[model samples]
Target: MNEVAILCVDDETVILESLQEQISRHFGEQFMYEAAESAEEALEIIEELNQEGVKIVVIVSDWLMPGMRGDELLVKVHQQFGDITTIMLTGQADEKAIERAKREANLYCCIHKPWRKEELLKIITTALESV
Candidate 1:
């Protein structure tokens, strides 16, 4: 079977760790979980994984970051890798950013910060099903 990955990008290390842990716990060993501290790092990871023949099926990203914003990253990803599913996880994102992501990136869903584990898992499950 082809290897698949799930990438979580956030500027906060704690958030990234929490997301990776929660997703791994819920999904077991079904997917390779990756965490990046910035959009640039996330893009690097995505490219490296693709080089290794691992398809990244989902990306969950925080909106406000130092460099490229999550929505911008998602839109770039959508342009380069149209098949990957993108989700926004943000506490401070405005409606316009979310709408832009939805319109341009085909965002799978937008989950607010302090998201319930169940909701995150459900959205991920749905995204995987769609993939």
Candidate 2:
């Protein structure tokens, strides 16, 4: 079977590392976890992974990225890959952006930064189950 992937996008290396560690610890080897430092890089990774026949089930992204914001990235992802689930993890995302994502991106959830590990895991687990 092609491995399913969970991609995390954040400019902060520490946040991405923490997310990868926590996700891997909870989900183990059932799915592959990937991270990107920028929205552009994440999009490239997604395209490459799709071309290689890997299924990306979920994306966790930061809202205030340097280039493309999280909502914009999620909207793009939804446009290209409608079935993939998206979660926004951000400290600075405005209400407008969140609402836009929810409407346009079919965003699964929006998590605030400094999120509890349990809450994050629960959201991902629930999303995966639904998927």
Candidate 3:
């Protein structure tokens, strides 16, 4: 079977750690979990994983990063890897950004910050089922 990965991107280190912990606890070793501090770093990780034949099935990202915002990042990822599902998990993203991600990136879903763990896990589970 091909290796699978789930990437979580956030500018905050604490948020990144929390997300990774929750996902790992819920899914166990079912996926290779990756965390990036910025959109640029996330893109690099995606490229490296793709080259290694690890399929990145999902990306959960924050919107208010230093450089590329989550919507922009998702759009780029969608353009390059259309099969990968993108999700926005952010506190400060405006409605326009969410809509743009949905329209341009074919984003899987948007979850506001301080998300419920169960809800996140459910969304991810559904996305993986579709993949």
Candidate 4:
């Protein structure tokens, strides 16, 4: 079986870079990490990757995005692709947003900003194990 690929989306380039670097440092070559600057770009990349038969097992998205928020993106992704795990990464997500994601999306977990490497690894490992 192919290794689990992870897609992380954030509007801020700095945040995106940090996530990519931290996740890579933690997991090494165990996961295929891909980052997108926005939900639109992320959706496009997901489509392309899916077409290539490179299944993305997890998606970590920021809640406060420019266009579609992380909750919306995750809900949409879950609707089309049921097996892809969705995790929200945000400094703070409102109650309404969290409720929506919980109802419509299969949220693995929410990781706050300035996350610790160990916590992120544990979440990823657990999420993958559930698959």
Candidate 5:
């Protein structure tokens, strides 16, 4: 997997845009950011990019979504792309979901809603470095 690629998935358009803007603003051209509004869309992007021979480094997803929750989507991602790091961003996540994600998806970390840009950037940088 390419280490400079980042994928972000969230159903909320505003949140997704904010993520893209914040990550870009903080890191500049250090990493490429790709965003999707849903798990289905994210999977399609993954497949398309994979066919183009590009590997993604990480996926930061929202925990609460319209269809597949972040944990479920991460699990599916882990199934197909085990080496890619995964993080969940959510305001409504519970202990059970965290436990499941940790075990099944090997989720690298969780970021709470309304995240601070610096803190979120640090978390992602750390996660990427460790992986």
Candidate 6:
């Protein structure tokens, strides 16, 4: 079976590392974990993985980045791959951006920065369950 993926996008290397560690620890070998430092890189990774017959089950993205904010990335992802669930993990996203993600991206949820590990894990678990 093609392995399903959980992709996390964050400009900060530390944040990306931590997210990957947490997800790997909790999920073990159940899902493939992928990370990208920018929206453009993440999109490329998604396309490559899709071509390999991998299903991307979820994306957790940071709101503030160098270019193409999380909301915009998720919206674009939704337009191309509507079935993939999305979660915004942001420290500084405005209300308008969040609403746009909800409406256009079918955002699963938004978790703020300095997030509780349990909360983040729970939200991801819920999203995966629905999938």
Candidate 1 lDDT at 89 equals: 99
Give me the displacement of residue 111 in model 5, in angstroms. 0.8
Off by over 4 Å in 5: 1-3
Model 4 agreement with the true structure over 80-114: per-residue lDDT tens digits: 99999898998979979887988899788988887
CA error at residue 99 for candidate 4, angstroms: 1.4
- Cα error of candidate 4 at position 11, Å: 0.6
lDDT of 5 by residue, 1-131 (tens): 33357899999999999999988787787777899999889999888878877788889999888888999999999999998899899999998998899999998889999898888889888887887
lDDT, candidate 3, 34-119, per-residue tens: 99999999999999999999999999999999999999999999999999999899999999999999999999999998999999
Worst 10 residues of 1 by lDDT: 1-10
| Clashing pairs in model 5, backbone N/Cα/C closer than 3 A | none
Per-residue lDDT of 88 in model 3: 98
lDDT of 2 by residue, 1-131 (tens): 44799999999999999999999899988888899999999999999999988999999999999989999999999999999999999999999999999999999999998999999999999999999
Worst 10 residues of 3 by lDDT: 1-10
lDDT of 1 by residue, 1-131 (tens): 44999999999999999999999999988989999999999999999998999999999999999989999999999999999999999999999999999999999999999999999999999999989
Displacement of residue 43 (Cα, Å) in model 4 is 0.3
Would you list the C-alpha lDDT of every candidate in the order shown?
A: 0.96, 0.96, 0.95, 0.89, 0.88, 0.96
lDDT of 3 at 103: 97
Candidate number that wins on lDDT, 4 or 6: 6
lDDT tens per residue, model 6, 28-59: 89988899999999999999999999999999
Clashing pairs in 1: none
Worst ten-residue run, lDDT, model 2? 1-10
